[model samples]
Target: MSWMEDLLLLGIGGIAVSVYGVVAGLLLLGIDRKLVARMQARIGPPIRQPFVDVQKLFTKQNIVPEHAVAWLFNGAPVVALVSSLVILLYLPIGSIPPVLSGYGDLILIMYLLTIPALALVAGGFSSGSPYATVGAQREMVTMISYELPLAIVFIAIAWRMSADGIGDPFSLVTIMQYPLWGLVGPLGLIGGLILLFILLLVTPAELSRIPFDTPEAETELAGGLLVEYSGKNLAMFYTAQGVKTLVMASILIALFLPWNPSGLLGLGGILAAGIDIAFFLLKLVVVVFASVTLVRAMVARFRITQVVGMYWLFLGLMGIIALILLGIDAIGGA
Candidate 1:
């Protein structure tokens, strides 16, 4: 394909993935509503309720706090939503590669992942509400706690990629396409699985889902970090959240499920794409259901202190073990 053709394909793919993100996000939320209701043995709203909720939020009146920094408060959701959209542009969807692969790297993508949280911090602090202030503190603590394990997890993956003879482990596409299972030893696989488990735990927290949702727990903090947002601003934040969840799932899929959608462009390619998408959605739903909703329903919310301890001690240990295993593998290969 010509450069122009590549750009067109890239644009089309990005748009399609964004649409998929919207659809998947809405679908997951609806499923969560129904599932939560069923888990509680209560009747839930209709499946279409998420769309209705977003519509209502958008049409609602804008409510800015008197003491708030107006510009920063207003800009928060825009930054969040735009960062999520940028992530989508960097992801490969099905048979399509990223629009700007030249600008993409796993490390870069990981850093970009922090933008939404930073946006939340700005929005929360600017609100000047007591609830928002408290939520902001919790958000910061959570970020600090989980980030260490997350960084170790990525480093372990990159190390495994290097061991595989994939030329620069930092290259997103290069590491992504390298067959992890083939390269890593048994111990490394075990460690990688543990690392993957930690990431799975962190994913919902990163996306502000339940259990790890102390920052926005409705019952505890009265909508918590988002108490001050309203109207289009709130809608923008909500949409950004939906996009973030999709982007997280896509990253997981890319890193772990890259083998599917085999590169042969024909019926085989179509079959590969279909199967890959099905498995991708299946895995995503399973993660959402098990880690997010199920855990939320089963366990009471953790106090901020407990959450901090949980990530730093338990998850951090797991990540270190994974890194050690990766290092051992590299030594053994050498």
Candidate 2:
């Protein structure tokens, strides 16, 4: 195919991935709510609750606060949702390659991950609400806090791959091809597990979910960063939240659990792809449950100070130790 034809095909693939991301993200959110409720012994909304909420939200009128910077306030949610969708296009489904493979890598995705959060901060500050302003500040701080350990997790894995002579160590496709577990020996395996745990801890913060959800502490900030958003604008942010959750889980799968049962069972063709995709979704569910739902259910919101310490101090130290172990493992192997 010519370049124009290839571009058109990619556009079609991008659309398909966007739709899948939104639907799957919302579904995962609904499941999370239901699971959390069950843990608390209370009945929860159905698995379609997020979908219903989005539908209702779009029908309601969008109210831009009179004092708000109308353009920035109105634009933030669109940016957030669109950026979240773009991140999904670069992440592969089970047996499928990413829609825009070779054009992007994990580092680009890491940077892309921040755009939605920055958009939220911009939206909140533009709203001109004290609560939102505070929320935006907290969101900015949270992003800063998580960066060290998050980068450590990425660099450790990619470096290990590089030591193993894996080409394109920064590529998600390469990570999937030689999962860290298979490449690592005993100490590296422990280090890899530690990195996975650290990433799981970061997932909640990345999505602004509980414990780390200081930015949207509804109790204290009265919806916090989103205090002034309503109707369609709110819906887009809500959907973006779900998509970000899905994106985080998908990244975790690519890193830690990229195995396919089909290959082990000698399956082929459509059957292999079907089974692999099914297995991948199952991993997403597990990752989401462990990282987001379970953690949120078990913990109260952390103070902003505590949030910083947890990520930068505690997780950061752990991440450093993990990197050291991986280094030792590399030397020992050599």
Candidate 3:
């Protein structure tokens, strides 16, 4: 294709992926709510509750606090939503290579993963409320806490692949093509499992879901980072939250469970692609339920100090152990 044709295709694909991210994100959030309610033996909100909630938020007045940096407060939501959606463009969804596969890789995706949280921190600090400021600090702390284990997980996998002679080990396509599970021995399998567990634990914190939601503790902080937001601004944050959930789940799927139904079933053509996409959605729901909904429903919020301790000390040590095991496995294999 010519440069113009490639650009046109890219634009069209980008639009399609954006629309899918928004709709799927909201749908997954609704599903999460409904599932959590059922798990508690109560009638839940409809699966469309998120959509209704966003619509209602949009109808309300978007108030800018008199003490706030209005531009940063307002712009933060856009940044969060856009950055979360951009993650999808770089991730391989089911049988489809990432829309921008060649343009970026897993390293870029890791960096992108932090952008939404940073946006939340920006919004909170810019809001100028004491509660918002505290929340912003907690959000930054949470980001710092989880990043070590998260990076270790990525490095462990990529390093394992590189040891096995794969080029571009950090590439999402390369990682997907040679799943860590297939490349490892018995010890490496155990290490990979540990890394997967660490990543799964990181997911709730990364998305700021409960037990890990210190930044948005409604009871104490009164909505915390979002205390001052309302109307369209709040709506954007809500949508961004959903998108972030989807992005995190997608990342977990791409890393730990990159399997596709079509290949297993010996399917071909559009039908295979359709089945694979459906299967991918199923995987997303499962990951979200396990990492987000179930954890939120089962655990109470942790104190900020405890949150920091758990991630930085416990999870960080566990991630180091996993990486060490992988290193040993690589040496043994060699």
Candidate 4:
């Protein structure tokens, strides 16, 4: 294609993915709230409540603290939202290849995943409130804690693929094409299941949901990292949270459940694409429920120390065991 055509395609694809990310992310948040309410035997907000909240927030005043770094405080939300959207461009949605698949891979996606949280940390510290500073520190601790198991999950799968002589094992497309499950033996299957469980647990921490939301403990820190944020700035953070949820679930789906309904049904063309997209959305809901809704409903928030210990000590050990099991399976198969 010509340079002009390439630019046009990039623009079009970027817009499409952005729209899908925002809409679907908010929808998932709404669904999650409704499900949690139902589980607790309480009436829930409408599925469109999140949209209403965002709209209301946009109309409110945006206040910058006199002591805060105004530029960083205001710019953080945009950075967070934009970085989250960028992940979708590298991720395969349904049966569609990523818009920029040739340009990046899973490792790049992993790095992009940290950008939003880092932005949040920057925003928190910039707020200049003691509470916000503490929250920022906690957020950094959470990020560092969960990263080990997350990295292990990626390495374990990629190692198994490379062991089987697959090139580009770290590529999202390659992993989706040859799912980790199909490459493993019975032992490795069990190991993969363990890793999958760890990844699901990581999802809540990545999104700062309940049980892992120490950085945003409303009761203690009075909104914590976002204590000084209001109006449009707060709304941006809210939308970014929703988008991050979608990004995490999408990555989980791509890594573990990359199957499409169209392929199973032996269909093709636009009809297949439609069915596959619907199926993909369904998978996203399942992931959100299993990883976020259900887990949050069952547990109370953990202390920051507890969060660090849980991720680095407990979950980290489990991930190592899973990797070892996969390694043994690889050797046995060879």
TM-score to true structure, per model? 0.90, 0.99, 0.98, 0.99
User: What are the per-residue Cα lDDT tens digits for candidate 1 across 1-334?
Assistant: 5989977977887777677777777777777778888898989978788778888988899999999999999999999888888887777765456667867777888889889898998999999999998998889888888888778877888877876667877765775667566677888788778877887788878877777888988898888789999998988888788778778777776766565545543346567778666766776676667656676778777788888898999999888888888789778866
Worst 10 residues of 1 by lDDT: 258-267
Tell how far residue 332 is off in model 1, in angstroms: 2.5
What are the runs in model 1 whose C-alpha is more than 4 Å off?
1-14, 261-266, 269-275
For candidate 4, write residues 1-334 as lDDT tens digits. 6989988999999999999999999999999999999999999999999999999999999999999999999999999999999999998899999999889987888899999999999999999999999999999999999999999999999999999999999999999999888889999999999999999999999999999999999998988899999999999899999999999999999999999989779999999999999999999999999999999999999999999999999999999999999999999998
Against the reference, the lDDT scores of all candidates come to: 0.79, 0.94, 0.93, 0.95
lDDT of 2 at 114: 96
Tell how far residue 100 is off in model 3, in angstroms: 0.3
lDDT per residue (tens digit) for residues 5-41 in model 2: 9999999999999999999999999999999999999
CA RMSD per model (angstroms) = 2.6, 0.8, 0.9, 0.8
Candidate 1 residue pairs in backbone clash? none
Tell me how far the alpha carbon of residue 20 in candidate 1 is from the true structure, in angstroms, after superposition: 3.0
